[model samples]
Target: MKLAATAGGGLFLGFSWTGSLASALEVVSDTAIAAGEINFNSYLALSPDGIVTILSPNPELGQNIKTSFPMIVAEELDADWTKVKVVQAPLDTNKFERQVTGGSGAVPHSWERLRKAGATARHMLLEAAAKRWKVSAGTLRTENGFVLNPANGKKLSYGELATEASKVPVPENVKLKDPKDFKLIGTAVRNVDNHEMITGKPLYGLDFYKDGMLFAMIQRPTAFGLKLKSVDATAAKAMPGIVDVVTFKNNVAVVGKSTWQVSKARKALKVQYEAEAALESSADHDRIFKELLNSTDATVRRKDGDVEAAFKSAAKVIKSEYQCPFLSHSPMEPMNFFAHVRPDGVELVGPTQTPERARDQVAELLKIAPEKVTVQLTRLGGGFGRRLSADFALEAAELSSIIKAPVKVIWSREDDMTGGTYRPAVRYRFEAALDAKGNMIGYKLRGVGMNSGNPTREDNFPSGAVDNLLIDSVEHKSPITTGPWRAPITNFLAFAEQSFIDEVAHAAGKDPVQFRLELLDKAKKSPVGEIKYDIDRMRGVINLAAEKSGWGKKKGVAQGFSVYFSHRSYVAQVGEVELKDNKPVIKKIYAAADCGMVVNLSGANQQVRGGIVDGLGHAMYSNLTFKNGAPEQENFNSYRLIRMKEIPEVDVHFVHNGIDPTGLGEPALPPTGGAVANAIFKATGKRLRNQPFAEQEELKTV
Candidate 1:
């Protein structure tokens, strides 16, 4: 059955195609949004009592988009920021277009749309007052909450005219305030949700609860292709507080009154699984990648000049192979979800990147109308692409629908690590040719594993678009499943490519930052024939980072510099480090980014810093291993993350081009891995290629 239609006449949609309840869910539409009282006036509502309610459509995952997005609208509406109280918007895609938040596009893409919302509402308020007092609309101006007509000395607060203004038509082509006139856009504002976070409120999925809610835990097989054969419900059902032992598809779920009870029951339940080919191990991934490198079956992403002839005729040749291990997301809060299912409808609550997707998936699974499904989004402890999958939410929906009651399913830390949608492990083979003058003339990159494969069809990134780029992927083609991770395959490819460039710089006796800038300069000025990048802007970030980090000057120790651009954002990083007791120590980090017009400087800065720290953690101490097709890394004790003390001081600077904004969250990440590796090379003369550098041998500083 058709669910709801959006204001723009699009169907609100939901689904769980991956057989997990989460993958199938999403909010497709909400026509009521555009027709509602608050909808006609921008997303913010100011009452006579001086109370302000800010509608936050996207999930707040500690990125500060919650505060920043509203700030853009509030600035245009001339609303008092301090008087604002923010609430998470429901899964209403009709009202909140493109509500799926990821890729750092939240603020940059939504800035204009949200500002118009505010401006339209403000215009309506002024018009209402102008008509009431018989004055020109232009003469009736609004400030804070009051609308004043100076000509007649008549004034009315927004609260007094709220009902009347609701009847006024929403203005089209409403004038937006100039950026220069903004009182808060470029300024640093504290996160509106920070206080609730620090005080530990019930804002996250883990904190969600409902009366008579049961907790469920699923027992998965030991290997990817293994299937559940049989289970003895007797033992699990006998456990105190355990409700029932039900089998859904292949796995058995134990439901109980508490998470611990359910988990213990699931573990104790006697279960057996059919075994399939267990040959797909970590070592197998390495073998398949190597085969791809050795094969001639490659899809060309980009090509310019006769690169082959350039290499053969040139003076020098340099080659390198780099590898990166699969890694886990490891959000502080393990993946969890709350679901309530009844004969009439279903309710699902969780921290998710795609709320609308969750709604659709669950409805399809239950064979119910889309309107019967409701998804309540919670603040994510951390996403990094793991939450992008609705696996946990889907599982809860499925189990709750079967159990005919409200249920919350929580994956233990072990389950979270071993069960995570891992960032694909990768291998890169790079070859370059240089002239006698130490100028690079030719380059080729052959990527293996998933990097050679296609990204999700939904993302729309052309598969293999880099000039001289070759992608040759050999999927294991087994029953094993995987999904995208933070930066996904691109992150893996970036480390290898950027680090190899650093190696080339050292071989040619050139400054690393200067060497990259030259390439970017070439791409920008000349016609590359539809190359997917802004070369000049890329160089701008590199130069900005170099200047800010004192690239050529030795302040106290060694530093490494690197630059990379992706998802429409450009970033350059400088990592300051020192070698002590055979380990690399990061002293400081300087980051320069160009994502266009600055919306929230503070939030942008914070996102860059966080991405850097995340990349640093992956470089220093993160890896996901496998045993007989099952992940071996089961928890934080094994999969290390950067702690508070290990976090280096991060300084972020944004390069303003006075244009539209781009993504800021991810672009800053890929370069951090390469920059840190380059710096470690300086401190220890080691070119550490593979990840989890903590286990690599340390080089002595000369």
Candidate 2:
């Protein structure tokens, strides 16, 4: 990519396939890029009206990257935040290599590059001002989009120097501002699109429209291991607004003029599915998982000192089993995509987390090169790892290709809930051996879950945290499709592991927080195998949370504490619960996170709050079960989500360390389940080994 002057004397940042600006030029424009706007490479642009537009390459899924990313650029550029505008960049692999946004690495991945881009612009502007004023470039300083000559107290706006700055040679190296001098970052900046969002503007995938766009809904098989056998759409075709009925390999689609008509026509159609064999049920999964947990044939993921000898010589041993059910992503905006497939190429518009992968999938399906597919991302209502699959976008492309027109496929809440690709059900058996001093001597974990293979992530917490540790995993084969949900394996593992740690603390007659601190200290001083976690960071958050929560001083309310590290971030959470009518009612949650340097304090706080609420909701009531290969829960009525009334006020704190930012989207979530579960145990004296804690019989008893 290279910067060039536009025909209107404005700057243009042109992208080329060969990196050489002379060949294969493409200039993509969006609403954020006004006519005659001065472009500064792929990330930044300046207009004559003093509007600094920053291009955000990553898709925004409520993580506030739309606001935070531009803040990074504006801070380095010395551009006024009030004058900065963030726009979503069109997907260009040659310019921005990775357009995906699932791992919460957008800020970390783009930090240096974006800062450099901004600094480069600042340097060029300084050079232009120096040439005009015949002064030393080093003597000039930029502040809020103005280059100041402190010697004479003279200043010039960036817009005034745009033309001359574009002619200045791009600097190969530029000095970045010190973090201590940062003004925009580490401060609370409201989302740039907050106005658009609250005003109900057209921003999401469902809001996209065309002159003759058709609506489509698919009639998917109810069972997991079933295929569409036959579909009779005789009555559906005769219905009002119905355009046509088409059948794919696995599903039948009802096409119409509107989403409501298509949905109604889908219900009128008669469909049948053929199961390959006896459909697997939740009972079968449980039985197989239990058997596999006990089976000797297992993969040994991690093995340290002799666990057998430690257990044999231990003064006491504790054993427990924990199970978590499958979960759905359940983003507020259900899966929907608009696709226009021509003979030459395909154009897709939607809210997907992985657009590059989706583009490749569409290209492959159409027997064309990957470049033939173009995917434009929209503001996502919610994407808790479900949008990473790209199946919905591919589905829209398939239907559009068949119809030879632009079609939008919309999935109802029922379709999103029962459709495949869910969080896998997992079972964990934990064994802890304690010596006479109440110190945990040995630890063993047997995890059984379904994935393409085993979903057990061996490197999860309490792995390197223990010395005499043995981690084994067993896989149970099933027809149920599963994918990443939020924190993935860590989501369930943290709950089971941390809750078991609380039990160990209770057995040792020690405070949960104290016990965890001791273990973290041990892991820090006397290391084990490949400690991927930062013990100091973990202890920092734990101590901060304990101090902030007034952990041991609370009366009348039972408190539970849990700390976990994932996605290179450490988090500790404490939950306060009160028993009412033989049920545990959560009152508040205290969360401490160490996600390196926070980008947007307000956005980071909201992320932690949302994560804690999401984790609690899933643990307390969310569950997915299958009977005869069909999902038991169809919608919100059956698959329960924590309502506003059930949500507790989350108090968030972050460790103020000057480290590079890690992931914030998922790290705050893992500890919430364990904290809530431990709190329930303290309140009702019941060990809730299974998830959906509301269904526990112990809690049901008065």
Estimated TM-score for each candidate:
0.90, 0.95
| Cα lDDT, model 1, residue 485 | 66
Error of 1 at 546 (Å): 1.0
- lDDT by residue for model 2 (32-141), tens: 23335676677888766677879888888998888888888898999998878788876778778578777767877888888898999999999999999999999999
How do the residues 1-702 of candidate 1 rate in per-residue lDDT, one tens digit apiece?
121111222122334322223324354343633212233443665443444566788887877878877887777767767766677876865567777777777877687898897888788878888778877898777777678777777778765675566568876689988777777778888888777889988889999888888888888776776888888889779989999888988778899999878877777888888876563677777777778778866656556557778778778888888887878778888889988887767778889988888888887888887777777788888888888888888899998888888899888888787774777666777787888977777777666654325522211111122133223333334344556666666576666777888888888899988777666665555544455566678778888999998897985578988777777888889989986666678899999999887777788888888889888888888878787878877877777888899999898899978777787768878888888888988887888788877767553333
Model 2: which ten-residue window has the lowest total lDDT? Answer: 15-24
RMSD of each: 6.2, 3.3
* Candidate 1 lowest-lDDT run of ten: 457-466
| Model 1, residue 699: C-alpha shift (Å) | 4.9
